[model samples]
Target: MANSNPNTEALALGRGKRPKLDNETVCMRMSSEIRENLEQIAEQYGCVYGGKPWLAGLLRMIGSGELLVVPAPPAFNVKSAVKDRLKRKHSS
Candidate 1:
């Protein structure tokens, strides 16, 4: 039976892998944005950076494909930073 709820179909998008290309796999316009974001993130992780990217690491996340081009989570240290600055100023 088909899914009755639209939400089910939306959530199930790309949940399964398509059959692997038998002859040769051809990638289309995958946008340079993907690579740029991936490289910046990989550099932050101290993963493969600068030199040629390691193939093994790429294989591990092939399931995510180019969608891994997400921006890094913002860091929050405001409270700690303020406390440390106050301490230094008072101590001086």
Candidate 2:
């Protein structure tokens, strides 16, 4: 049988009726710049959480209205490249 709710536009999932939202969840979209900034920050934050990505931790704290973009540590990439070069030198 169809649901008794009067506010539904139509049925969903073959259910009786769609739900009425008294307090609907809001979806917020951000600009590309904002998204990129968040991702970078999340990655850096991810580094120190027992390998738990920074994004997950940041998302958990989202309600405080504090977003960040932390600069990656300088030695991160340099060490990788140096390791690669050393490997190549040893292989040759």
Candidate 3:
């Protein structure tokens, strides 16, 4: 049965609309020491700045071309992920 209330209809339609993809996720394995160092840097920078320190730092590096993104192995088939990241960077 369809929802009779206008508010309910609107809410149901709103749920169908997905949010725009603005960021691409990258998953990598890192050592415990590296994770600890990153956390420390993130905390220190977060105190100095207002936003998320690690994310901010990563974005800054990517924007400045300081960070190099090597392609994932063929088995991973990560072309779409890379494309999305490029699109996101260009859009911003």
Clashing residue pairs in all predictions, respectively, total: 0, 3, 0
lDDT of 1 by residue, 1-92 (tens): 97677676644676565656554444445445445444544555455735745333453455457426454446957457556755775599
How far is 85's C-alpha from truth in model 3 (Å)? Answer: 33
What is the full ranking by lDDT, best candidate first? Answer: 3, 2, 1
Runs of candidate 1 with Cα error greater than 4 angstroms are 1-29, 49-92
Where does candidate 1 have its weakest 10-residue lDDT segment?
A: 54-63
How do the residues 7-35 of candidate 3 rate in per-residue lDDT, one tens digit apiece? 76666567768788687677768765455
Query: What are the TM-scores, per candidate, against the unseen true structure?
Result: 0.27, 0.29, 0.33
Error of 2 at 29 (Å): 1.2
Q: How many residue-pair clashes does candidate 1 contain?
A: 0
Per-model lDDT: 0.52, 0.58, 0.59
Worst 10 residues of 3 by lDDT: 44-53
lDDT of 2 by residue, 1-92 (tens): 97789766544354685567575455559875455455555675553366544444567555455654466787679447556755775599
Best by lDDT: 3
Model 3 segments more than 4 A misplaced: 1-21, 47-92
**Candidate with more favorable, higher TM-score: 1 or 3:** 3
lDDT of model 2 at position 76: 72
